[model samples]
Target: MSRIGRLWNSLANPDRIPKLFAIVLGAVILIGFLIPLDLNVDQLYPRPVPQEQVEENISTAPYARGGEVLESPGITRAQYPENSKSLGWINSYMSPLAIWVASTSPYFGTSIYSSPGGLIDEILYYTRGFDTILESTILMMAFVIASWLGVNFTMNRKKREAEAAADKSKDYYDPTLNKNKTYYYNNQNSNIKEEQD
Candidate 1:
């Protein structure tokens, strides 16, 4: 057969199914990592906390001495600068989640109340829990398949070695025998009988 045909046959072998599956899974993970995440801030946080309210609260706080508050404006998307393209893209997409988490977290003292640990806990336990479970299950199955294949290969090798050893022992020469032990014994018995007669 041709080289391509042989390669195809090898790849299609049932014994290699686990390896093929692992390769596919690895490719999927690679693709997922390469794809950029797109998140809309407006959709994630429909009602953001007003900047005026935050500033007012900070200004009137006991920490503010002589009722003086910092008047510097916060950084906007247009004003933000980044040197790396990949990092910039990641920051733009992930900033919404960060904003949502910070705004909803009880630690930040926002108007919206969230459970302890906030949005992060909710996403991990509720939204993304199934994906985590499936990933772990697939990993475990791959490990099991690899271990089973290794064990079977070792067992088969040992069995072949034992068979070879047995064959070698059977084929060895015997010092007490001539060409064949049975024939040598038969001929000797016949000669003894003839002499007795």
Candidate 2:
């Protein structure tokens, strides 16, 4: 048989399957929290160039230099925008889910280049929104999972306890029951005593 087949056979047992699933799921969740998303939000539009600089360049003309667009830094590279025309970078420390949620808000979602009204508006509704949403989702999911496991565990424990109690109540020839209990006689007229404890 193949190695995979052997592994599956071993783990497929009723006793081991749940443990295997829990271990694999826990590892995935841990890695997801550790990994960071690669989000460079500079693909939206041409880099902004100030009109004053363009005018200044025209006044101090160099005959040899052709009229070419000057390279300027994109707004998204900055941690925060000073004015209305910056797209700003999302926090690097945020989880992937949080980043996705924050960056995909209505204002930031449709267009990362467009102004989000103001800095507070951008931060509250757009950038930091991911963390809020992710936290709520985690809490909700945890509540649901905990309730499910709790119910199953409680029911299984009760069932096992009831079965044990029922087994104890059964009338068996337990030698520990009573030392002076009378035993039924055989057809051959022999008084056979019950086995000693």
Candidate 3:
């Protein structure tokens, strides 16, 4: 057979093709991680919070400043330059959920975990990691399942078609002849021809 004919024959037999394909795909994902380039997203970033939005959210109270209520213009509230913001980020990875065991504030002794945004940011980061793993697992599983189902469906269809063809061949070979009735009719016809003679 030519190369094309050989390929066609192999394709006609698809029992292990899907399993082979799954192995290849898994290997590629495992080893084919390409480092991303061109990630300079800062060049396209529209300045952080826009001047008007920052101004609007700025402290409107009289004690904020004399003429300018905005200390840091165009900065987001998430990055509001408070005294604790830098300290909070430095201690984030350590016990990001709760930095201290005890608290002596008027807010009923709430621990470091009670600090706003500390716990939430850590949770979001780890949750994102878990989500990445889960999403990859689901995608690979889906690929395998879809390929297996498709191959099985094709095989069953081929089987049914083969059975139908065999049935058609059988019909052609057996042309509705009854053995006992044919023997009797043949003998009777010969006797009538002899009587006429």
Best by TM-score: 1
lDDT of 1 by residue, 1-197 (tens): 68877678667556688988899999999999888998776553133355643566542121111211123212122212352122112211213453476445433433233222323322344445577789899999999998897776654656654555567557654423223665877789779656643
Model 3: per-residue lDDT, tens digit, 133-170? 78788999999999897776654656654665567455
User: Alpha carbon lDDT of residue 27, candidate 1?
Assistant: 96
Candidate 1 Cα outliers beyond 4 Å, as residue runs:
1-39, 43-121, 163-197
The candidate that wins on lDDT is: 1
- State in Å the error of residue 84, model 3: 19
Alpha carbon lDDT at 29, candidate 3:
84
TM per prediction: 0.27, 0.24, 0.22
The TM-score obtained by model 2 is 0.24
Tens digits of per-residue lDDT, candidate 2, 21-118, equal 89999999999987887767564322334454344443211111222122322223223345434333321223355336545543222344333233
* lDDT, ranked from best to worst: 1, 2, 3
**Which wins on TM-score, candidate 1 or candidate 3?**
1
RMSD to the true structure for each prediction, in A, is: 21.6, 19.5, 21.5
Per-candidate total of colliding backbone pairs: 0, 0, 1
